[model samples]
Target: MITVKAPGKLYIAGEYAVLEPGHPALVVALDRFITVSITETQDQGTINSRQYLETNFHWRRRGDQMIFDNRDNPYHYILEAIRVVEALALEMGHTLRVFDLDINSQLEDQGGRKYGLGSSAAVTVATVKALIEFYQLPLNRLDIFKLAAIAHFNVQGNGSLGDIAASVFGGWIAFSTFDKDWLRTVLKNNTFSEIIASDWPGLKIELLRVPSELELLIGWTGSPASTSHLVDRITIAKFAQKQQYQNFLESSRRCVETMIKGIKAAEVNVIKDGIRLNRQLIKQLGVFSQVDIETPELAELCQIAEDYGGAAKSSGAGGGDCGIVLTDHSVDQARLISAWNQHQITTLPLTVFELTGANV
Candidate 1:
């Protein structure tokens, strides 16, 4: 059996601007993950499937049709992931038969759907890795990236791609599309290796999961916003010479630099300031209507977090989804949780984890 576990990601900086041609972004891999395990079946050439195993969830391929039991709607993400693997197998002129695949994902904080955490990208990464191992395909990280990109495009049209790259590579990365082809050149020329081999100290990161004593409240705006729609709107606005948007990007870039410095220096106050500044910059984008963030519920929650001495911001593509909040003080956490309870917002505990490559 081959198992692949891919971590989800959080964009610490360069959220929407990363999609621009010359902008760079930084991201961190979270402990939240999507894991896939696959093994060959006795019926080497035929496909059969099962769902929700007594011991573990099961999925089997029978001929061209893949079947599995539906335990939840979130499994739709898993189904989408399988489709990508199936397509890749066909491209390789090989068919996988009697394969038992199990998918397990952990991202409850987003209530199963969050933007900034890269849940889809994580699934894509794990699915691609499982397929590569199952077919014994001779593909490297770049090859996996290409496949994951295809899946991401299919799921979320014109995805930022930064999330997938972060999930696949892990650690803090300064990614730029400045030259468009620069990334490919760097990979081919071993630029990453050269940088790692140097004597420079690696970046420092703190993974703060929501403490059990505190509640990380997340409220969804009833309206579902398409990431593609927002991206298109921003693109058109940028093309039309929207000075505010440009200023937002520039400010975001500066915030990114400050964040890097804060992380390096281990200054909690600087980190807090950077978070607040970044939130203000995102608010300037004017993507959220009627609310400074996304949903009124989320905005209210942010207020509660702020009252508790924490900071809150929208997690992803922004029309509506989850909000991320960070707080370490216990008294503040108690007040935050009380506020969330009064408002009836769902809360979860989140922790920051070290960013590591997806090899398991």
Candidate 2:
């Protein structure tokens, strides 16, 4: 059996702005991961994910194509990965043998409650990794990332794919969303295989250096927000008042830029300033866009962190889920968690997931 794993992601800054082309966001991979275990079977192949699907999905081959016995399997990402890798392998004149897949994730509890830690992206990356290994495909981490991005886009029509990039690269990263305009145009002009044939020009991702003195305190609000729903609402709001949103975008870009520089330089003041302004701008965006992005609980969480001398804000879509506190000292990290616990918010025991000698 071969087992592969991919980490979940957290957004440090640049949530909505990163959706646009050419804008950069700070993303970090956390220790939580999705794991995929593949084992050879005799009669038929099975995909079992008790953590998610609660039942095994058996696979059958119809000529060169792989088909599932039950068509309505809940684990769509895993199915997408199989279909993608199978098509690519056939294109390369290589036929694949089947195997049973056992999938699990640390990003969610057995109750199926997500922490908003990019579990979907992690599963996608893990599935892609396991298939690449099984098929013996000559693909690098970046190649797998691209394949996962395409697979996810095929499943869900909208996303910046920042989580996909984070799941691929691991650790601290500066990521730009793929060029939506160019991608849309290419999709119109070329087939999926032909599009994957060339170097993707729409995306840019790189590793960023994080200071050793910094610490992250993640607090969960116990409410899961649907990111796609939040993103869809925000997109509609942006077009409703283009001028106002445009201004918000400009300020957001600058705030993220400053935060990046602050992390690089280990300047707490600069980082704090950026975090404060960024949260305020995001709040204003909610007002201008007429979307209830931030919740009262999240606001109280941020206020608590700020009172403890840490820069805190809602990490992702902001209706609920989790928030982060950036502090220069470990003492602040401990204190923030304690205070948040007092308010009934649980602090996740997570740290940055640095890629250490593993591919995919």
Candidate 3:
């Protein structure tokens, strides 16, 4: 039996601009993770697969013939990862036969929907790891990262590819400009290149489980915004010479650097100030508003958090998803819960994971 676990991630800075060539992004691997396990089937007659969030996949073996049971609209990203494994097995002249595969995922909630906190990337990483172990494939982290990128793009249509790299490498990462065509060519040649790591310091994150004890209150708006849509909008705005948009990107870069320092020093007040400033700057992009971050009900929750001397900002793709708050005063757990109830916003508690590289 082989089992693999991979971490999810959140973009700390340079969200929309990272898709462009020159801009870079800072992302962290979160505590939430996806796990996959694979084992050879003892029945020797059929292969069975069970996956959460979708129909079961089954296949029968008659002599050497393999018959697959199809799933309607199978999660495209997972299928893509399995395809990569199949290709590698074909190259090695080994046919994947009877097997039992199981997948389990734990993700944080953004509003009501599962706003992607790199869940696709985590699944891709876990799939690659499981395949490598089950098939005894001689592939490294870079190879797995590249394969996961292909799978992610197949599902997302267009993505930054930074999330896959962060998931595979773990910890914090700074990605330089990536040219997909160039990367594809390099992969064909079986050659790899080194990337420069920036000097941004790391932060000490404490994982908290008490939902009500959080000084910062997070809530979701009702609107669902697509990451790809936001990227396209930002790209068009950049082409049209929106100076304020350009300024927002530049300021965000600077803010990341400052935030890194604040985290290292454990200066909670400085971190709060940086988050507040960054939220105001992000609002300048015209993508979000105070109302968008919180509904009339959630607005009251924010007011309660603010009364406790905390600041709140949207998490993930924004629109109507999760919002993060920072506070300096003592947390009023009861009041916070009451406020969320009054606003009809479901609150999810999260703990930040310490940054670490992939386990070899």
- How many clashes (backbone N, Cα, C below 3 Å) per candidate? 13, 0, 1
Name the candidate that leads on lDDT. Answer: 2
RMSD of each: 8.7, 5.8, 8.5
**Candidate 1, run of 10 with poorest lDDT:** 47-56
Clashing pairs in 2: none
TM-score of structure candidate 1: 0.67
Best by TM-score: 2
Query: By the TM-score metric, which is better: model 1 or model 3?
Result: 3
1-360 per-residue lDDT for model 3 (tens digits): 888888877665556556655555556566677787888876562223233444334577989998753321235666788877667666767778666667777753422234446666787788878887888877776667766776666556556777776677666566533665554554466412221111111211222122223244445444444555555555666666567667777887677556666656676666666666666665666543222322343345456656656765555445555556665446565676667666676665544454345454
Candidate rank order under TM-score = 2, 3, 1
Off by over 4 Å in 3: 21-26, 41-74, 85-100, 108-112, 138-143, 169-177, 184-225, 287-304, 327-334, 355-360
Q: What is the C-alpha lDDT of each candidate?
A: 0.59, 0.81, 0.58
Residue 349 of model 2, lDDT score: 89
